[model samples]
Each structure stands twice: as C-alpha cells, then as structure tokens.
Target: MKILTIVPAHNEESTLDSCINGIRNQTIETDILVVCDNCTDNTEQLAKSLEVNTLKTINNVHKKSGALNQALDKYLLDYDLILVQDADTIIDNRLLENAVKEINKDTKLGAVCSKAGIKDIMSSK
Candidate 1:
C-alpha cells in the first residue's frame, strides 16, 4: 500500500526536525511531505534540508486545516493512505506498521488514528 505522510506546519522550525526524523524512522517506509502553511520562519528551508517533499500553502487563512486541505486536494488520489500529522508531534516508530496492520485486518476500516500523549511537566520537577 502506498502511504504518504502529510505534515502541516506553520513556523514550526524548532520542532520540525524531530518530527521529520520520527517519520523517516517509521518501521513502514512511506513518503513524507511537509505542508508549509504561511510560515515566516525557516520551516521550508529546514524541510528541504531534510530531503523530503515540501508544499507551500497559498495565503492560507484557515491555518492548519486549510494547509492540510490544500495538500490533500493535490495528492489525495496519488496515495492509498494519507497520514495527516502535526508539525511538532513525533510519532512512535511502529505507528505506520501498527496502523497498516489494523487496516489490513478489517476491510471496513477506513482510517486509523493514534491519540496524542501530553507531556507531564510536573514529572520533570
């Protein structure tokens, strides 16, 4: 199955590297595309340096959703599964592998999702 990971980013330069690296290290090999949404930072440059496909949003006013919409519109028909990922979220290495496994088990499964885990700031203290 052809899987494409779309990362919607807006001035997320600080966290983009980790996010990209996490995607790259996924157990399931998939293509990565960074949707640069109205960014004023080095988000595009950073993504390019990481050697992944980059898509720049055109005057996106709806923020992350709009940015994702733009990318989905253009690339939706190309890939079997489209993974919409956050710019700063670092997913587990087995995420795609586990997700694909679940999808394959059930023919009715249209999508798979992982709930985000919040960092406990108090635990660090």
Candidate 2:
C-alpha cells in the first residue's frame, strides 16, 4: 500500500532533522510530505536537502491546522493510507508496522493514531 505521511512544520528546523531520521528508520518505508508554513528558519532547505517532498504553505493564518488542511485538500486522496505527524515528533520504529497490521486486520478501520510523549522538557536553571 502506498502510504503518505504529512508533517506540518513552522520554524521547526531544530527538531525536523530528528523527525525525518525517525521516519527514515521505520521498518515500513513511507513517502513523507512536509508542509512548511510561514517559516522564517531553514526548514524548507533542510527538507529539500534530505530529498523529502515539501510544500510551502501560502496561508499561515490558522497555524498548523491550516497547513495540514492545505495538504489534505490538495493531495490527501492520492494515497491508500495517511498519517499526520507533528514536526517535533520522532515516531517509534514499530509504529508504522503495528498500525498497518491493525488496520489490515479489520476492514472497518478508517484511521489509526498513536500517542505522543514529550521528547524534551526544560526548566529554568
């Protein structure tokens, strides 16, 4: 099955690399689409450098949700499966495989989502 994972990003240059790496290391390879929205950083450059598909969002009024919607409306229907991943997220290696298994096991599965945990926390020293 052709799977497309959409990653909505805005000024997330620092975390983007990790996110991409995590995706790449997944057991089930997937096409990644990153929506770079109103980014002042080098997010687009980084994505392009990694050879990942990227779309620059012209409308940035509604935050990440708008960027996500822009991608979904224009390109969502082209794939058999879709995953909306955050820019700062680094998914576990088993996530894709596990999700696919669950989805395939049942015909009624419309979508599968995973829980996210904080990767880092900072405290004023």
Candidate 3:
C-alpha cells in the first residue's frame, strides 16, 4: 500500500523543516510531497534539500483547499492513500501506521481528526 502526504505551505520556512522531518522519521516509508503556494521564502529550497517531491504555484485561490486540490490533481493518481496536511503541522511517527492498521481491521472509518494546536493561544489572552 502506497501512501502520500500532501503538505500545503505558504511562507512556512521556519516550521516546514520540522514538519517534513517528522514525516521522514516515521517507521513506515511513505512518499512526501510539499506544495508551495505563493511562497516568498525558501520553503521550496528546503523541500528540495529533503529530496521530497514539490509542487509550486504562484496564484493563490482557496488558501489551503486550493493548494491541496492542485496537489490532488497532479499526484493523487500515484498514491493509494492521500493525507492532506498543513505546512506547519507536525504529526506523530506512528500516526500513519496506526491509521492503516485500524482501517484494515474495520474498513469503516470515514475520517479521523488528529490533535492540533495553535501557537501561543494561551498567551494571546
């Protein structure tokens, strides 16, 4: 089973490295694709350094959704399962493995939402 992680990024050079690294460190081997949308930083360069596939777009449309759609159109055919992730989001190494195990066992899970947090939300108050 082939899995592809599509990360939609826009000027997320600082956090992108960590996000990609987290995916790379996973026990299971999966393809990683970073979609650089209207980026003004070195997001593309960093992704290239990681030797992961990258897609860049100059025109912005649906923010996260648009970038994901573009990636889906281009790379969806190559992967059996597609994981849509944010540029700044870092997931656990076992996330994909666990998800695949559960899916294979039950085959009834339509969706699963992972844990997420915003930076400095408590400090804002």
Best-to-worst lDDT order: 1, 2, 3
Error of 1 at 70 (Å): 0.5
TM-score of 3: 0.85
Which residue pairs does candidate 3 place in steric collision? none
Give the true-structure RMSD of model 3. Answer: 3.7
Candidate 1 has a TM-score of 0.92
Cα deviation at 40, candidate 3, in Å, is: 0.9
Question: Cα lDDT for residue 90, model 2?
Answer: 84
Model with the higher TM-score, candidate 2 or 3:
2
lDDT of 2 at 47: 93
The sequence of per-residue lDDT tens digits that candidate 2 reaches over residues 1-125 is 99988999999898898899889888998999999999999999999998999999985699988999999988877998888898888899889988899899989889887876665523321
Off by over 4 Å in 1: 119-125
Better of 1 and 2 by lDDT: 1
The model with the greatest lDDT is 1
Candidate 3: where is the Cα deviation over 4 Å? 117-125
Per-residue lDDT of 26-92 in model 3, one digit per residue for the tens? 7778899999998889999999998999999757678888888888888878887777788777788
What are the lDDT figures for the candidates, one per model? 0.91, 0.89, 0.83
